[model samples]
Target chain A: MARLREGLRVQLNVIQALTSRELMTRFGRENIGFLWIMVEPLLFAALVGIAWSFIRGPVNDEINVFAFVVTGYIPLTFLRHSFGRSAKIFVANSALLYHRQVKVLDFIFVRVLIESVGAMMAYMFAGIVLAFFGLFPFPADIGVLVLGWAIYIFFVLSLCTILAPVSEVSDVVEKLVPVSIYVSIPFSGVFNMASWLSPELREILMWSPLVSGMELMRYGLFGSAVTPYYDLGKAFGVSIVCLLIGLILCRRIRRTMTVT
Target chain B: MIETRNLHMDYRSGHVTKHVLKGVDFTIKPRDRIGLLGRNGAGKSTLIRLIGGVEMPTKGKVIRRMTCSWPLGFSGGFQGSLTGYDNARFISRIYDKNYSEMKEFVEEFTELGSNLKMPVKIYSSGMRARLAFALSLAIEFECYLIDEVIMVGDKSFQDKCKEEFFEKRPDRALLLASHSLETVQQYCNRAIVLKDGRATTYEDVSEAVAVYKKL
Candidate 1:
């Protein structure tokens, strides 16, 4: 518990540095500095929606294709970027790590918070723009939607912390990032609801916490029926386990990993 | 009250382990100023690092009954992109202290003037050395581990350093590691000369200088 308290304090300091640097370096010395945070990600979502228009039919049948893509793209963007950067954090901020008060977990937590917050803000902006154009109705349940996003963010943060060190040592894991994205693209549970999966298939897929998180999110926000295997118990279990494993991995490699 | 018992450090590079500190022991008491003198690669810097908790020993323990500052130098610690003022804030936060007082002191002492607001990477070596020295002195550690920091700066700042270090912080114990004979003799009472990773204690400052000179 004492360690936890200390970790929280260190995390606060890390966040201060991370946010200051991110805001300063990214926005630069321009007048429309802060506005770019929302604009950039929404632009990417727009581009993807446009590209998908030509590749196939609609991106989703249940909702406006753009809205569906925006919903899925926002969280995943945060997940991917956080994981990618967090993996190399120890190397990137060696100076900060050498200080006694700065911990390995603090660095990872700061990166996760910054990326997740930025992505969420961008998603909110996109939602407002789409609403103005009458592209989709306001979300059915704002509370559930927010909760689902929070849970998904938590799971991804834990997973990235665990995978970061492993990815650093092996170029194989780095190369596999996009490949994993491509493979998981079909199973993202965005286009197809988990309710449609066969009982056996649902049971097997629930083993993947990412899929479980997405399925649970869909149910919470859209009142979509989840497969019989959609267990909040399982999602919570996997999240807890992954977080513990990640913490252990972080502790062991804290000293060995070179700060960049 | 600081001591290391049977401390051993091995710097491993792929296939070989080069022992920097091969089973050494030493003790430092309150207000006891000690100078560590040795030739290049004699593990002088390594010893200071181990004592400061920057690096852990492969075997044995560093019993620190008080806080110890890391070796004073403009090295791989400060963020190059941050201004000296911002860096000072970070250093204070990490040390769990107030930055306002130290920031003012460092600003006045470093004499970098407008350069304090500029990124640290843009500062000259002498300016960096001054900043490093000022940062170390700003943090009120129970024991300071000085490494090759006293040799820098003009005669006036050097005198300022001595007055502040000796007169103001007389109660603070110091472990100064340097090759400069004058610094070792003037700043420290007891001296430890490291040779091939082994530390030998000298009763008089002059005796340690003789050993250091021969090396």
Candidate 2:
């Protein structure tokens, strides 16, 4: 157990180094090196909100579309980035993996850590910017808001790590990445609430852990009495299972990786 | 000490598998300057890759006492799209070392002038070689697995490398895989001749050269 703990600590250090390198290379020596990390996702959410506003009229009458989009968009963006980035990390950086110290899990952890932290900062920035513009809506229950974010991050990390090797081995998954986003549109519950759906559809959609997360987040943000039939316990369970599966795949594939 | 016990490696491209290394047993002791000599298809580079931990053996083990460094090709451990400086930063990050500390040394050794700011893909092969050689030397490692010639760089840079890397870093062990027998005689005291995925060590460098030449 002590040896495992020490090994994990060392892996964490490697993740930290890779994260720092990604941050530096992505932003460069510019003054706004890291601030852009916050700005990029916030702007993406804003653009999406603006585009959605054109079709949906005025977003939510009681709840501003900006805030609604942020709660949904920020978390979803983290999920997509984590899954997308982590899946291809081994193949993309095979050169670095040649070194014995640089493990496959270390690469996945670095990317997930970067995307997760970047998304978190983007959320905070979105909140601050919305508040400044009088477009902010405070969560009705802060506990649920924090819990939703935690669950979303956990699930995204697991999903990405599990899918990464599969994506690398087959070009089909890589091509379907964008297609998956379009498919996930309705299931993610980004545009609607669980309470608004028919009970059957809602129950089925609630099976999607992301939908449950989004619905719970809305309950916290809107302060409305919404008793979601979605299981938070299942969401946590699936996240752990996905993570373990990902870890197993990574261990099996590490030796087969060859830098092109 | 770095050693491979009955190492076997087979590579599969499509339908057929090429048996690259067939039960090769060799050991590299601490501070053992060994030269690897073989023809193109003699599994010389493959053996180095196995020892460097770049490729896993099919049915054996590569035991290592400490971390080993490998300079496999011209642009080793570098992203061509990134600038020279960015690549340096990436190396330091991967190794868990300080980047700023090696900045001056890299700048002096590479002597790439203003080209350091440009993407490495834009640089000439010699320039790329210089960058890789410099980066390898920048990081201190106990053992080095060098493939091919280091003389691909300019004359002055090559001389500087010998002075600093070969003469200065005496405690560092080297496993040089090269076709040049003269280079092997100059740099390596011991020789390992690999044929049909097996290694036969020679105490006399002349004997190893003769064996390789006959093949």
Candidate 3:
């Protein structure tokens, strides 16, 4: 018990160091610095929301287009950014492995935390701005929204964990990840509602952990105006499976692989 | 104490497999200053890296009971965009050392002055090496694994490094890999000659240096 506590303390220290290093390296010392973390995603979501407002007319009669876009794009941004960068993290931060305290999992954890926090702040910031203009309403189920976001974060983290080690072992997987993410967007349910699809298609889509998360999030955000379809059991099961696989793969790679 | 048992490392590049360390066994105890000597591809650095826990061997295990520092003088650890101060703080935090003390030590040792506030990418290779060396010393590890001779800056800087590693920290263990027999003779009391993925330790530094010269 004492040893476990010590180990946790060491890991926490390492995680703090890694997160700070990541922040400094990414944002630099210049104007605004780490604030860019919040700004970059905000700008991306805002631009997409404005463009969709003009093009798509209204995503739903009761739901505001800006709110829908913010909800969809912000979470997708978190997932995409985290997963997109996961493959390259080992190679990019391989130098840090020199310190025995620093582990591969620490890198993934830091990245996930950064992306999640950034996305959450961006979502809230956009929601506030839209509410000020009377274009968006306060979420109907904040508790459910928070829970859904937590599940989505869990799924993203597990996916990233699986991808990080796989990418280290195979160059092909690294090359294909970005393209795969782009291709997987429609299936991710970021732009479309699950209720819009036929029962058969919706059943198939809900099996995807990301789609389930999106549906659950929209359910929490939009409430009774739209029916959200998701299987919480399936989503949780998928996330756990991915997490276990990722942990095993990462351990095997760390044990057998040499950092060049 | 740190020990490697029958350690074997092999690098696979496509169809080719290059054996780096084969059945190399050694132990590093407290206050033992050992020199590792080998040819260009004799796996001296590889042996140091394995001992440091930065890389895993293909066949055997590295048993580290005490904390060991990474291969010093390797400048790849620093993030290019972060200022020198940020790197120092990061290292301190990771090692659970006092950040202010580390920063002060690095600033004083490297004599980087205003340049310490600038991004490390802007510094010269020599400046980077100085910062790396200073940070390594600040951590105060039980055993230091040095890749080669950590030559940095001018004559005064070299003297300072020698003083810090040798004069001040005489009791600290060192496992240094270098081709220069003179450097090994100066700093190391014992030596190990690595050839064809094997290690032969000599109690007398001159004897190992002589064996290395013959190889």
Which candidate number would show the highest TM-score if scored against the true structure? 3
Best by lDDT: 3
Q: Supply candidate 3's per-residue lDDT for B90.
A: 87
Off by over 4 Å in 1: A1-37, A51-62, A167-192, A196-198, A224-229, A257-260
Which consecutive 10 residues in model 3 chain B have the weakest lDDT in total? B147-156
| C-alpha RMSD by candidate, in order | 3.0, 3.1, 2.2
The parts of candidate 2 lying over 4 Å away from their true place are A1-9, A29-61, A225-229, B98-100
How well is each residue in A1-260 modelled by candidate 3, as lDDT tens digits? 99999999999999988887777666655647546655665576678778887886666689877677678888888888898889868778887888887899999999999989888987887778779987678788988788889888999999888999999889999889878888988888888888888999988887788888888778788888778888888899999999999999988888766665
- Which pairs clash (backbone N, Cα, C closer than 3 Å) in model 3? none
Give one digit per residue, the lDDT tens place, for model 2 in A88-178.
7787877766566677777777777778777778877888898898877666888887777777777777877777888877779888887
Clashing residue pair totals per candidate (backbone < 3 A) = 1, 2, 0
Pairs in clash, predicted candidate 1 = A91-A260
Ranking by TM-score: 3, 1, 2
lDDT of 2 by residue, B18-72 (tens): 8888898877877788999888988877787788787777788999995688655
Candidate 3 ranges beyond 4 A from true positions: A30-59
Clash count (model 3, backbone only): 0
lDDT of 1 by residue, A90-189 (tens): 7677666556566667667777877778887887888899778865456666766666677678887888778776665666877777677667755556
